[model samples]
Target: MPDQHSTLRAQRRAETQRLIQAHAVRLFTERGYDATTVTDVAEAAGVSPMTVYRHFPTKEDLVLIDRHGALVAERIAASPAERPLVGRIGGALIDSVAALTGGGHGDDLTADERFLLARLQLMISTPALRAKHLDNHYALQQAIVDALGDDATDPDAAFHVRAAASACLAALHTALVRWAEDDGRTELPELVTKALAAAFGERIVDTPR
Candidate 1:
């Protein structure tokens, strides 16, 4: 039932994505994200000059985390139909801590996660990654705007829904920065709830370090 050309195209795109990510992760681990060049990735991936550019326009795009957008879309899509957007978004936010930190590490990450967090902290502290992070946030906000518009029938109501969405994401960001300092010993989901509540009202009781 599937169209062969469409299926082939999907396969090609997935392969290209894998190649790009593979090379990018290497350069990121070696010379660091900021110092790594697109040319370096192309050479490492054994692709033509234009092919690399075709997949990722800028070097930052090579490592940008659009996974956040995917998660946001999935979160909203799975929510109850009749719940208010704010409540659903809030619940999704509070529920997403597991998805955020629950995989890949085999044992207590006290050491491994420290190195992993250091990698993330490296990205966060780098100007290039920070710029990419900002770009990612704006793109994510636009997606939230689109999702809000889809869910709200009243033209005037959508704006408020999106504003609440923005607040929720901003709360998540605030909590992540604080969590990063803890080096992943503590759970981020708990911090997310406190941060979301604080963003709305009341002093968020930060879990004791």
Candidate 2:
């Protein structure tokens, strides 16, 4: 009974956080990000300032909160261990994009994809957000490295894992940048696969321009 109650509480908390973030994005879009305040987002979410602060410690947190690292890590951990590390990481990245976009493109974007697109646009346009975005990428790289479970006792193996993680994430970042630049007309999963192939010396096929 206690465990069930805790689970329900967690679900409710997640719902509240989602509601607050939705309101924050809408308000940030309506009024420039710089022009909006935590108070404003709280009012838009119909929650108290305290509640907003409890969910998002900083204004940037509202825009920068991301679950990509967890998604990538889970996929990498679940991938066949016999596969090359770079291939596993790269495949995970492409898979993550497919999951996010529902394996579709253009008008078929899922609500999550649309939300991510908006966040990407804001991050690219805002200098502060852009800086934080790089930090987020670094964190993502670390997550991948951790997921691969490189032996800390072997410096060479650890270094190799870190390098592969960084390289794969760079490819993913390039794909995301191009996706944002193209206004999401191209299929994101395709772009990710192509980018990873080029980076990892795999044969590249033409992706929709």
Q: Which ten residues in a row have the lowest lDDT in candidate 2?
A: 200-209
Q: How good is model 1 by TM-score? A: 0.73
lDDT of 2 by residue, 8-71 (tens): 9999998999899988887887888999999999998899999998988888989888778898
* lDDT (CA) per prediction: 0.66, 0.81
In model 1, how large is the Cα lDDT of residue 98?
Answer: 44
Q: Relative to the unseen true structure, what is the C-alpha lDDT of residue 12 in candidate 1, on a scale of 0 to 100?
A: 95
Model 2 ranges with Cα > 4 A deviation: 150-153, 203-209
* Pairs clashing within candidate 1: none
Worst 10 residues of 1 by lDDT: 200-209
| Top-scoring candidate (lDDT) | 2
TM-score of each: 0.73, 0.91
TM-score of 2: 0.91
